[model samples]
Target: MTIQTVTTTPYNDQKPGTSGLRKSVKHFKKPDYLQTFVQAIFNTVQGIEGSTLILGGDGRYFNREAIQIILRMAAAAGFGRVILGQSGILSTPAASHLIRQYQAIGGIILSASHNAGGPEGDFGIKFNISNGGPAPEQLTEAIYEASKGIHSYQIAPIQPIPLDKLGTYELHGMPIEIIDSVTDYMALMESLFDFDKIAALLQADHFKMRFDAMHAVTGPYAHRILEERLGAPKGTVMHGQPLANFGGGHPDPNQAHAKELMALLFARKSEFDFGAASDGDGDRNMILGKQFFVTPSDSLAVLAANATLIPGYRNGIAGIARSMPTSQAPDRVAIKLGLPYFETPTGWKFFGNLLDAGRITLCGEESFGTSSSHVREKDGLWAVLFWLNLLAEKQDSVENIVRKHWAEYGRNYYSRHDYEEIDLKAANELIAALLDKLPSLTGQTFGALTVGSADNFAYTDPVDGSVSQNQGIRILFTDGSRIIFRLSGTGTQGATLRVYLEKYEADTNKHDQDVQEALADLLTIAEQVAQIQAFTGREAADVIT
Candidate 1:
């Protein structure tokens, strides 16, 4: 095999956000686009020669092609071995685990998580460090800098390697192993969760659960774990197949995207006792009961409070952490448990340090992401299994568990409104205007709510001491209500302005109120302060969750 160094030019728009470089598939298909970015990674990250690397994706369109390109690049870049997932399928969390379990140098994951997929849809790529976490800010920045000035990329000139079989193959003298995507991940999950207990709950005649993989990467994992291993009925896992275009449905595990699952769970006298869904890359999860929805925040809080019931956490957890935009319900749990708690920025990478240092046992984000020290990235199936173990041990309905939790720890009414695909300039202007007004907004009163403080969110990593600034703008009210504003880069076109509204209700009587209705005052105040409609011409949020 001959190693070739192809000349290339830098693409100016290659900077990655917290989720990595996501863009339209057409953009990535540009000549030398993907090659340039992959080469930038190999060039920037040191110690590539003769090191092991992991590679796979969610089996979306172009996933196979991307894997082929990266494999060839890795062989030419002097990697000794590459662990490739069968049929180019690997969920985000599973990839993280593979990186750590194998002690590889790092891994390159191809996914535009929760985004639409297809030739016309989105595509993305991100490098995870040896710690099995998203490359931290410093490394990502370095990759971006390298992408800007790269003039050539190295690749092994070879035919594509077959990825359907679970066996080893040679690619330009480097050993490439096509491994079963679910076995290692399943083993890890079984270790942390009481699968036997969960299996009983799943097999019980009185209880029925539905897990929607949304035709994304979690289908096989769910099938292998829930049906084949745990003995759930055959049809328990819906959309349990990895499709290139996600079966023409948006694969986000949210109320808006997982419509079929939500409809089934919300139906009158719902057939299923519990319902769960995972996103495209299987890192985010949405949990529901019979006509009951569990917010990601509440899910974290409930799980943390009852973690000792699970086999893995029987000895108790080290601590708890949540994203700054996440509700404070889990923080309250941490306080009650007398465990350390941390509030970091939105990315799961922020939790990596704490998890690595053993400062936090569990961490979550309001974006339907939750995970523990078991993996660096959020694990959707793991969250589902955690809930399953909790349900099996408690021998109670999901609604009761959450209601009881609310009664004990109080309820945090929270909602996030997203104005997606809006004019980029307008969204930037809106956030810029808010940043300028943050200083004066303090002590101001708006519609019976008095602002106690306001500022752009920032954080200093306790473990690494690295600083991340301008995370988001937040307004805190004296009544324990808050409205946060941030620009999301997960979209392919335009900008997505996300406004998070939260209010703490200690009165148990108000716990039954509808989430949007409970936060109505905060909603009005958020719009009044941000002037979202005026700035972006959005009458209402494109999606609310």
Candidate 2:
């Protein structure tokens, strides 16, 4: 096969966020758009020539085509070998494990995360480094720089390799190996969790749990682990097929998107003892109980407080880390356990250094993302399994366990309000105005809350000594209530302004109030301070979680 160097023009809009470059499928289908970006990654990653690469996607509409293109490009780029998941199916966490297990130079993950997927929907490409984590800011910046100046992309002149079967094939001098996507990941999970114990719990006549895959990538993983290996009933995993358009529904596993699952779990007489759901790429999760919801922040806290019950963490953890937007519940756990804690800006990449340096054993974000030193990327099924282990050991209802945790650690009432697809200019202006007002907000009182501090958040990574500034705006009150404003980068459309509200309550009697009702005053304070309605022209947030 001849190696073809096709000349191409660079696109300046390929700048990646913390998640990687995401755009509409139409934009990616443009001539040379995907090629330019892929070549830029190949050029930016040093020593890629004659090195290995792992490749796969979430089985979205464009997943297979993207895999074919990347495969040919890898062969032409002189890669020694390429490992692919069968039928181009791999969850974000699975891809991360493949990268680390093979010690490949890097892996390319094709997913829009929780976003919708279709011919007209969004598509994305994320490059994970040798550490099995998102590329750090420095490396992503280099890729962006290279993309801006790319002139050509290399590809082998060959037919598309069959990805349906598990086998080895040759492309030019590169060997392409297609492997079962779930086997290794299942083995890793089995190693971390007590499968036998969890199986017993799953098979118990009195206990029933449901795992909704949201018709995305986790269907196979959940089916294999929860149903096949653990002996749960056949229909225990809902939406258990990976659909190209995610069944024409948003794959986000929040209260809004996973409405069916939420309704079933929150029913007046719910049948299930435990409930969980995972997002598009299977990196994010939503945990629910009979007539109860466990906030991602509280879930992290509960897991950490009872982590030793699980075999993987039986020896105990080294430390804890959470995104700045995540509530301080886990921080309380870190304190009670005397383990060190660190808070960084949003993005899994920020936790990579900590996990690799043995500084943190568990890390998570408020946006339904959580994991540990087990895998660099967040693993949704893993989070579900962790909860299962806790359930089996504690032999308590999910609500009771959470309530006890709250009674011990004090409940941190937390919610995230997302105003998605707002005008880009308006969102930028709102943040600018917020920044201008930060200096004057401190010591001011809105309602019964007095501002303790107000500033744009910044962080310095202790492991690598790198600084990231302008992360978000934080308005912390003297009463331990907080309102945070940050523009989300994961969306492909117009900007998404995310407002985070948190309040700490030490009284167990006060924990039963509705989340929104508990923070009604703070919500008013947020609108008053940020002027969200006037700025974004939205009377209420589009989604609240």
TM-score for each prediction?
0.99, 0.99
Write the residue-wise lDDT of candidate 1 on 388-470 in tens digits.
99999999999999999999999999999999999999999999888889999999988788999998999999998999999
Per-candidate alpha-carbon RMSD to the true structure: 0.7, 0.7
In order, candidate lDDTs are 0.94, 0.94
lDDT of 2 by residue, 399-497 (tens): 999999999999999999999999999999999999999999999987688999998999999988999999999999999899999999899999999
Off by over 4 Å in 1: none
